[model samples]
Target: MDRRRTLRQRLATQRLSAAPLPRAADVVRLLACVQSQERDHAFFSLGLRSRDTTYAAVRAAYDRGAFLRTHILRPTWHFVLPDDVRWILAATSPRVLRAMSYRHAQVGLDDPAHVTRSLDALGELLRGRAFLTRREIGAAFGERPGLPSAGEQLGHLLLLAELEGLVCSGPMKGVHHSYALLDEVVPPAPALGRDEALARLAHRFFAGHGPASLKDLARWASVTQADARAGVAATLAATPGALEEVEIDGITHWFDPSLPRRTTAGRAAHLLPVYDEAVLTYPAVNFPAAPGHPTGGAVDPFWEPVIVDETNAGLWRRTVGKDAVAVETRLATGLDHEQRALVLEAARRLADFLGRELDYREVTGGPAADDAKARRAAIG
Candidate 1:
């Protein structure tokens, strides 16, 4: 597929241009897991994915453990389903544990003997408490002569606890997140072997974030390139018709064959969060033909994106004030009448998600921004 089709196909696949997913539960289940380091933006990510899920709704689901937010997949936080957590950790934890070994030592958690003892103590601390905030846990884990007592080292110790499956996220304790015993919160399911776990994760990634390449899978999951290829290959071998590949710019792209090749019915607009799976899952994302857009994947991969019909037309950010949320858009390209209106609608959608009044502005700065401003002025 060419760049235009590639971008459009991705939009459809990620449910950005197509009909949205039903609810927060469906969203996490379908996408496999969502990267959610930015807590508030992560809620919006779920809001954006669903048909009409509000921020309140997402939070409610989270409070009930409909999905879990924890440190997984490259050391950042992700919202993974409870049942999927065990298998995914079984597949990826060894790599993650190895990656964090230096931190483990730096934090005085170097002794596996002590770390194991710490987990035992922590498990005892959390056993029937239902949930405890990290700060609360830290206090209970008072100063020990040789043990990690407080701050980063202590935090790493807790991180190790999480990786070991001793605990997982509890509901938000008011605005602060808390932790619960994994066995208490998560419903039990049969375990999966490492190879089977990898294969399952591979299938989910392609189904939700596809027309993607093997390299993308490796980077996102923090698995070896060889493991990623093996996982994808296993999925291909098991269900040949479930997946298909195409050469986009000479690179092989794997995708679920069941998704239709279509874009949104009209000019759609979005304020996709930074690290939203739709944006971060792919190493390089193609865009529609527009001035200032790179012919190749041009998104810088850091900023929040302003999308119009599968194109990252510009960038955006939100500031939550007392009474209203301020949404500012920096356009890199011109928008026509309908496109401009669609962007406003998108901003309102965000405001509605936050249950706050809309305070929207389009700021102009650089040459591209100035050009876009001039074009919008002319159009008006």
Candidate 2:
């Protein structure tokens, strides 16, 4: 199996290289979860994957509790649908809590009773109000000794409460995101059994982000290796013939059975948001880069927006002025007229989403050049 061919197939299957979903929540629900460490970018992440989805529309869905942002897999913030949030947390939070123990101790938050008390305090405080910003929540703990609401411990405390399903994100207040009690934010979603939850997760992972290996699933879901295998087994049992195991370059990988055949003759080049799952999920596979050497060192794959032509081409970023949004691209190599036009088309869509005029620019003599050089050298 050619690696680039496999990646292109995976991208098309994930809807990144095909027609977008119909709704913002649909995008989130399809992926099961989206890494949302960056807020405004996360909005664009959904918008870029949807049919006629606007920034305003995505924000509205978020405001309406159609999807929620909180710590899920790997103790990082992810955008998850309301119904899936409870089951995901139920299965994974214990592991996350255990992982966070050392950090909690480092910040004097290792005491379970004290942590419980803090969760109780935040729960009571949130019940009295519709929502509270991080600062407001911090103030609610107001000089309370031994409380983990000061310094960086504040975020940790909030994360703990989130794991326990006490609080979650509220609508943005201007530029600030606030928090609300999970119980009050939306009705309780039905829970799933542990085995069922793992199976469902395994299915979603492969369905939306597949052609992956057990290692990829474990890393992405933050589950144990044993659990990852079990989850895959359960998924196979639950939906026979849904997954197909294929050997790529002598290494076994699993993917959905129903991926579209290779077709990239006329599709426009795609400039995806930073940490887009299309690029993030398969971190182990280096596309448009050398095989067996995923991106790292010098080029931070998580930091820049990915440019996808046939495969991962390079990175792009945008700067906003009063009249227009200036899109600066640092490609690994040059593009043809058609490919450049397609990239521009993507940038135009982004400008439309932000209601800004477009000012496209090509950066020179910077990291893009260096990365291209490095890629060429690696391939040679």
- Which candidate number maximizes TM-score? 1
Task: State which candidate has the highest lDDT.
Answer: 1
Per-candidate clashes come to 0, 0
Q: In candidate 1, which residue pairs clash?
A: none
lDDT of 1: 0.79
What lDDT does each candidate get?
A: 0.79, 0.77
RMSD of 2: 5.0
Clashing pairs in 2: none
Worst 10-residue lDDT window, candidate 2: 289-298
Cα error, residue 281 of model 2, in Å, equals 1.1
In model 2, the Cα lDDT at residue 215 comes to 84
State in Å the error of residue 158, model 2.
0.3
In candidate 2, stretches whose alpha carbon ends up further than 4 angstroms from where it belongs are 143-146, 258-266, 290-298, 301-305, 368-380
* Model 1 segments more than 4 A misplaced: 143-147, 288-303, 366-380
